[model samples]
Target: MRRNHLIALATLGSAALLLGAWGFQYLGYAPCKMCLWQRWPHGAAVLFGVAAMAAPVAILTLAGALAAATTGAIGVYHTGVERGWWEGPSSCSSGDITGMSTDDLFNQIMAAPLVRCDEVAWQLLGLSMASWNALISFALVAIWLAAYRKSAP
Candidate 1:
């Protein structure tokens, strides 16, 4: 395939993922802090894909791959957090309230993030959205890399 077509396909993959996220949000599935974090790289990848299409630069293609990898990593981390493999950031992870003073507890509650990252809001066939994102983003990374390789001499 031509470099432009490859770039377009990679770009469309990110665009489709973004649209799916929005569709889930519209369906009342609120994204947690980590969920939101995973999205930024996909957004960057989509932009990079566009730029790569325009310039056909190897650097831009690699940048898109990097962005895809970033999101994939984040999604993996989120999956770990959701599965209790490790504690997520304090902002998004639930904590022990047992030893806290009443005031401290109240303050923690007030300052807690609107959505907890450790919980899976939705799942399919036992895989959460984050899991799906990781799988798809990794695929995007491969496609971006293929485009880069094909673009090279």
Candidate 2:
């Protein structure tokens, strides 16, 4: 495909993923902090895609690639958090509460978010949504790179 088409495809791919994430949210999957963080880069990429189409600047394509990579990295981090490979944000992750007073513990429980970043609410074939995002976003990165290379003089 031509550079513009490739850029459009990559942008559309991000839009589709974002829509899917929102769909899942609408279906009652409340996104945690990390999940929400993963969406921003996709949004930026979509904007970058528009700029790329309007101007076809190499820099915009590069920015799109970076945006994709940012989301992909966040996805990987979220996957690790979900799998307990590492800790997530304290506000979103369930941590030890043993030292807290009874009232404090109760308050913490009551104030806790409905969604926990450390838990996988949905998955397919042992891969969580974050994992899928990472995989797909990386593919989009490749598309962005291809567009960039194609536009290179």
Candidate 3:
């Protein structure tokens, strides 16, 4: 794997992630907080890929790999949150509401996000988007690592 190859792979992965999100949105599937959380690192990976393409540098490829890995880790955490293996953030998931006025409750309900990070809106072959992202992003990370290894002096 060369720098250009790694860069291309990273870019393609970012494009795929973006397109997948857009497709889900287009189909009326809104992203939860965790889903939104998973996208930033992919965006960074894409940018790093672009930089690598522009300069064909080993550092940029490694950066892209790091970004991919970050997103993949987040995706794994998200999958756990969805599967009830762990708890998600209070901003995305339900939490204890022992003390709250009716107005506060109403406001919370009204301001609450449409999507719940703890629930899977879609899945295929028992894999949700987060799982898919983990698999794909991890593969991208491997390509990047291989590129780095092969380019080592």
Write the number of the candidate with greater TM-score, choosing between 1 and 3: 1
lDDT of 2 by residue, 21-140 (tens): 999999999999999999999999999999999997999999999999999999999999999999888789997787899999888888888889999999999999999999999999
Ten-residue segment with the worst summed lDDT in candidate 1?
Answer: 90-99
lDDT accuracy of residue 136 in candidate 2: 100
Stretches > 4 Å off in candidate 3? 98-107
**lDDT (C-alpha) at residue 102 in model 1:** 95
Q: Which stretches of candidate 2 lie over 4 Å from their true place?
A: none
Candidate lDDT values, in order: 0.91, 0.96, 0.85
Tell me the spans in candidate 1 whose CA falls farther than 4 Å from its real position: none
Question: Sorted by lDDT, highest first, which candidate order results?
Answer: 2, 1, 3
Residue-pair clashes per candidate: 0, 0, 0
* Winner of 1 and 2 under lDDT: 2
Q: TM-score of each candidate?
A: 0.94, 0.94, 0.89
